[model samples]
Target chain A: MAARSLGVVGARVVVVAAAAALWELVTRLAAQPYFPAPSTIVPRMYELWFSGPVTHVFLTDDALDTFPPSLGRLLVGWVAASLAGIVLGLAIGRSRVLSDFLDPVIDFGRAVPPPMLVPIFFALFRIGTPTQIATIVFGVIWPVLINAVDGAATVDRQHLETAKVFGLSRPQVIGRIIVPSAMPKIVAGLRLSLSLALIMMVISELVGSTSGIGYRLMTAQQNFLITDVWGCIVLLGVLGYLLNSSFLLVENRILGWHSRARQNA
Target chain B: MLEIIDVTHTYGAYQALGGVKLTLAEGELVCVVGPSGCGKSTLLRCVAGLVQPTGGRILLDGVPVSQTPDNLAVVFQDYSRSLFPWMSAAANVALPLRRKGMDRASRRTAAMEALEQVGLAGAAGKYPWEMSGGMQQRVSIARALAYRPSLLLMDEPFGSVDAQTREDLEDLVLRVCAHHGMTIMLVTHDIDESVYLGDRVVVLSRSPGTVAGDLQVSLPSPRDQIATREHETFVRLRAEVGRLIRGNQLSPQET
Candidate 1:
């Protein structure tokens, strides 16, 4: 298994390198102002992020300021949305009445685009961190909420009967059988929501925020710093990839049985 | 002891069960046999108080069973769904014990003991999905055993297993029931199994399931799959019960 995963990682590295080499060649030939070669972007990324004093731990002031706030906003918003989504999802999923009554409302909220809500939220909370956080929270909560509801609602029928026959109380049933059964799907939903949270984080800051990776990208664009813009894009991609891998580490541990079962099958 | 008196159940306009009456004495192992779509599962659910019969009542120890009684447990037909896949086998058994206010340590001890009883002590730490169909079913049985209920209801518990595994499970049930003197109502469509495991066999008709016949088995205990099946009493009882079930007639005088 370890050898197989190693091979997979090796192949992925080759693919990425090949793509970068092709991009560098095409852009050098074209010599476009908007499109910098991979070589330019790599050194510029290093200069922008780690061009500070050697004693300063390989991070510049811009890196320290922009990266942390973006990360902080993403984490806080995602965590809050996840918890609230699961709790509310479980409650709504378990009851036929509440789910029915709230169906139309949930549909409406999910239907509205995240960018469309940006203006509405800007009016409510002003152009600041609050608006940024709210936008992300609003955008990412739906996938987790809807999937959690589906997962909780569709727990195997026999398991519910077994719970009843065993004399487990309503709360006990929900906590033990319902939630655990729903966990795999909930984790899947969480993964989708995580990516959405990253996207929403950038979109939220695009119009209002003073600091963030997105704002930095916008600033670089306005200043015609083409290499910095490419560098920031690469940085965002790496950050997104790292965040997703971290979530997977936890997910694999939680749903280890499910993955093993699928592999054997 | 439990009593199902004049129990009638309907699903919308369709009558699934009509006047199904049964009386189970203390420490009795009864097998309920019937054809397909006979509502045998519904009867077990009604007994467990998981479903309400449209008419009459189920009385456990002279008390009407409107809700699931504290001392009753059921092993559902689908072991894959009944056992929580996320939990270890022992944890699955221990989950029901949580409501009884047992602490974690005691519940673990009891779960281990119950798993030991079901010959699945080594499987305690394994998840249900990690095990085979038969092993998963054993875990479900262990869970029911761990509950230490006064009455146990098994709804087609061994229907999904192979023939050899089915016989092994049947003997396991017999051994466990004899050892604990636990009252059991096992639902099955297999004829030989009904006589093999049950002290008494109750036959039901198709569709609107109701008591068609009840036969007492005088066959000796410590029954072997081969020897007991070949025994004269086992053969005679099986044949009689088979005829009665096929006939769809309640003839107590004939038995």
Candidate 2:
């Protein structure tokens, strides 16, 4: 099992490396000024992270390190969205009355294109980063909330009865039974929400942020600096991958019993 | 002692139990035999306080059973569901004791003791789904025993297992009841089982169910399944129970 998993990890590494190489080759062959090769982007990514000049890339002549502010906003907005979505979802799913009332509203909110909300948020909040963060939070909360509610509501009736028979109170039942039972579904919802959060983060920054990877991308586009645009894209992709992988690791750890049971069966 | 007085239960418009009366003395194993949909389950549920009698009362050691009495525990038929799937067999057995204010280590110790009684000490760490149907049912039985209820109610506990497992479970119940001095009320559809397990077999009539006949078994205690089946008294009791359950249609002279 250990050897097989090692092989799988090795294959993933190879695949990622090959994909990056291909992207670099394609851009180089096309002679696209906007698409930076991996070699050019790697050094820039390292410099941006560790030693780049601290100034707005658009406003300044030199490289403006922007990874920290972008990462910080993404983390805060994503966490807020996740917590709100899960709590709301569990409440809505468990209560038929609330779910019925909120269904259409959630549906409408989810259906609206996230990018279109940027202007509305900017107008409402004036020119602050909170408006962008709010836009991302709004975009990401729906999926997590919907999934959580569905998961929590469908906890096995037999198990619930067993808990009642054992004299578990409402909170005890929810904590020890409902939440654990609903975990897989909640995890699935979180996965969806995570990706959406990343997309919303980038979109919000691209449209309005004075500083962020998205702002750097926009600046690169205006200046026709293809290498810098590619670098920003690469950085965003890496960040998104890290976010998703970390969530998966946590999910695997918490749900190890479920996976083991499945394998045994 | 447990006394059920003129119990009647209704589900919406349908009357399930009507004027059912019964009593169980301490340490007595009474089996209730009836056809499907005859409200045998309803009677058990009423006793367990899982369902309230629309009219009448169930008194356990003199107090009316409003909710599940502290000294009562139930073994339900669906063992897979009755035992929490996520918890280990020991944990499932220990679950009821959470209400008793026992600490975690004490609960674990009591659960292990119960599992040992049911011949499932080796399976303490296994999940319910990991064990066979018979073993899972034993875990459920172990759970009931761990609770140490004065009045133990089992609702068709072995209904889901095979004949071999059913017989094994029946003997296990008898042994546990004898050892622990548990007063058991077991509801089953099998006539042979009713005779095999119960000190007294109570037969119920058709829907809107009421007790038809209650007969005491004169067979010896610490009964062996194979030897007891061949015994004259066991044969006679099985025949009498079979007749009684089939609407008691035979004339008294014929019986």
Candidate 3:
């Protein structure tokens, strides 16, 4: 197993290297101003973002100006949406009255595209971090809510009966039984929302915002600095990849029991 | 003490149980036997307060059981679903004790002791899926034991395991009842198991079931699987319970 995984990693590295080489060759030979070669883009990216004192962790002034606010907004919005979604989802899922009342409303809201709501959110909050955060939370909350509802609703009959027989209180039943029972679904929803949160983060910034990667991408494009535009795109891609990888790492650790149990079954 | 006073339950138009009556004294082990769909499980559920009968009532220690009673636990047949997969064996056992107001350390100690009672001390840290079906059932039994309930209900608890495992679990139940002095009402379709495990066997009629017969088990104490099965009294009682069950199967529905 160890050797097989190592071989897979080796193949991934080779494919990435070959792809980069091909892109570099094509762009340089074509010499199109619209598509800068990786060679020039790499130097500009390094100078813009990574050249700084050791104390600043190699972040230049532009890097400090751009990365933190965007990341902070993304994280804050995502966490808020996750917390609200799970709480509301569990309530709606477990209660017949609440579900009956809210199901149609949730369905209608989830159907509308999130990007289209950005203008409305901007009108409500008026072009600032609030608007951006509002846009992100609205866009990403549905997956978490839908999945949590499904998870909490479908808890096994035996588990619930056992909990009842033991005379568990409402909180004890929810905390000890329902939440853990619903975790596999909850985690799936969280992972899906994380990717959606990243997309929403960019879209929110692309329309309005002063200092984010998305803002940087817009300015670079308007200035016709095509290489910087490419740099911003590459940065967003790296950010998305890192966020997803880290999320998976945490998920695997916490949900090890779920997968193992599934295998056993 | 537990008493069922003419319990009747229906699911929509279909009656699951009809006018069933029984009683269990403190520290008694009674096995309820019947054919499939005979409402043996429904009867157990009514007593455990998992289901409320449409008519009649259950009283635990002179108090009417509208909700699940204190100091009560159930060991369900589907151990895989009953035991929480996310929790370790010890954690599952310890979960109910939170209601007992046990501190974390004491809960852990009590859970360990219960697991040891079920002969699963070494498997305390393992999750339910990591163990065999019999082992998982043992964990569930340990959970009930840790709760130290005044009453324990088993609804076909050994039905899902292999024959050998079922025998081993039967003996384990007997030993736990003796050791803990817990009042138990075990439901099963296996007639021989009813005789082997219970101090008395109560047979129920087919669907919309009612008590058909009740017989005392006179086998020797500290029952051995081989010796108890070979005993004349044991054989006679098993045959009697079997006859009662088969007779109920052939009879017409009684109101």
Using lDDT, give the best candidate's number: 3
How well is each residue in B85-164 modelled by candidate 2, as lDDT tens digits? 77789988887788889999999999999999899989999987788999999999999898888888899999999999
In model 3, the clashing pairs are: none
Supply every candidate's count of residue pairs whose N, Cα or C atoms clash at under 3 angstroms.
0, 2, 0
Between prediction 1 and prediction 2, which has the larger DockQ?
Answer: 1
A122: Cα error in model 1, Å: 2.3
- What is the lDDT, from 0 to 100, of the residue B66 in candidate 1? 95
Candidate 2 interface RMS? 2.2
Which DockQ-derived CAPRI band holds candidate 2?
A: acceptable
Per-prediction TM-score to the true structure, in the order listed: 0.97, 0.88, 0.96
What is each candidate's DockQ, to 2 decimals? 0.71, 0.40, 0.84
Candidate 1 error regions (>4 Å): A53-56, B249-255
lDDT per residue as tens, model 2, A1-265: 8999999999999999999889778978987655667888887756655453455433333334466667777788888988888888888888899999998999999899888988999988966579878887998887788889889898887677667656776787877788878887888888888888878877898876788778888998899877677777877787889989999899899886677667665
Tens-digit lDDT track of model 1 for A126-188 = 888888889999999999999899998998888888888898998888888899888988999
Q: Residue A82 CA error for candidate 1 (Å)?
A: 1.3
lDDT per residue as tens, model 3, B1-255: 999989999999999898989998999999999999989998988888888899998999999998889978999999999999999999999999989999999999999999998999999999999999999999999999999999999999999999999999999999989999999999999988999999989999987889999888988999999999999999899888888888877536543
Q: What is the per-residue lDDT of model 3 for residues A182-258, given as tens digits with 9 covering 90 to 100?
A: 88999999999998988898889998789888899889989998999999988888899999999999999989999
Q: Which candidate would rank higher by TM-score, 2 or 3?
A: 3
In candidate 1, list every pair of residues with a backbone clash.
none
